[model samples]
Target: MKMLLTVEIPHEPFNSLVRGGKAGEIIGRILEAIKPEAVYFTEQDGMRCGVFLINVENPSDVPAFAEPFFLNFQANCKFRIVMSQEDLQKAGLEELGKKWA
Candidate 1:
């Protein structure tokens, strides 16, 4: 399934990584591992943040995806299932609406 991964890095570790010049290397390694379909980095709530779109084949794979951020940056990570337009269209909403209505 398609998932959106959001990572928020706390100030202390993030600043440390930036000062040590290891931020890019760490992020690069993560990107290489996940191979996300899309990724964007920005600030959120005044902290470093990343948004990634990826495919997760199994629920058990979440730990692998999340652990690096936790161990390296003490990041707060969240994942949400997402669907493309074609996937949404297949949800049978019309039938559900009729049944409920």
Candidate 2:
């Protein structure tokens, strides 16, 4: 399934990496491992953040997606299931509404 991975990187470790000029290198390595469909850099609650869209095909694969950040940056990671338009269309919402209502 498609998942959204949100990473909030703390100031100390990331600042050290940036000061040492290794930030991009590590980030590139992590990105290569995850192979996200899309990634964006932004700030969340005053911390540097990364938002990624990726596909996790199995339940056990969740850590594989989030662990790079955890091991590398001690980053806080969150995973949320997401859907494309085609996925929404296949959700059977109308049928469920009839059944539930």
Candidate 3:
């Protein structure tokens, strides 16, 4: 399934990493390990954030996607399933609407 992984990293350790010029290196390592299909870095709620789109086979795979940030940055992570337009089109909504209507 396709999933969006949102990560918010607090200031303490992350600030330290930035000061030491290691922030990019750490982020690079995480990106290398997770291998996200698409990744973005931006700010959210006044914190540093990483947004990643990835595909996985099972919920158990959550740890592999999240643990690096958690242990290294004490980051807050969220996962959500997403569907493309093609997936939505194949959902059989018309058939369900006919029955429910």
Candidate 4:
């Protein structure tokens, strides 16, 4: 399934990493491991943040994706299932709506 991974990194440790010049190295390592379909870096809620689109073959794989941020940056991480246009078209929404309506 396609999943969106949002990570909000707290200022303290993140700042420390930046000051120590290790932030890029750490983040690079994590990104290399995941090889996300897409990734964006930005600020959220006044904190450093990263948004990643990735494919997760199984629910059990979530921890592997999350642990790097958790351990390195003490990040707040969230995951959500997402759909492409093709996936949305394939969903049986019409039948479900008719059944419920």
The lDDT leader among the candidates is: 4
Per-candidate TM-scores read 0.96, 0.97, 0.95, 0.97
Worst 10 residues of 3 by lDDT: 53-62
Please give the RMSD to the true structure for each candidate, in Å: 0.7, 0.7, 0.9, 0.7
User: Comparing candidate 1 with candidate 4, which one achieves the higher TM-score?
Assistant: 4
* Model 4 bad stretches (over 4 Å): none
Q: Whole-model lDDT, candidate 3?
A: 0.94
lDDT of 4: 0.96
| Tens digit per residue, CA lDDT, model 1, 44-99 | 99998999998999999999899999999999999999999999899999999999
lDDT by candidate, in order shown: 0.94, 0.95, 0.94, 0.96
C-alpha lDDT (0 to 100) for residue 44 of candidate 3: 96
Cα misplacement distance, residue 68 of candidate 2 (Å): 1.1
Candidate 4: residue 101 Cα off by (Å)? 0.5
Once fitted onto the true fold, the runs of candidate 1 whose alpha carbons sit more than 4 angstroms away are none
Worst 10 residues of 2 by lDDT: 63-72
lDDT by residue (tens digit), candidate 2, 1-101: 99999999999799999999999999999999999999999999999999999999999999998889998899999999999999999999999999999
Give the least accurate 10-residue stretch of model 1, judged by summed lDDT: 9-18
Candidate 4, after superposition: displacement of residue 38 in Å?
0.2
Clashes of each: 0, 0, 0, 0
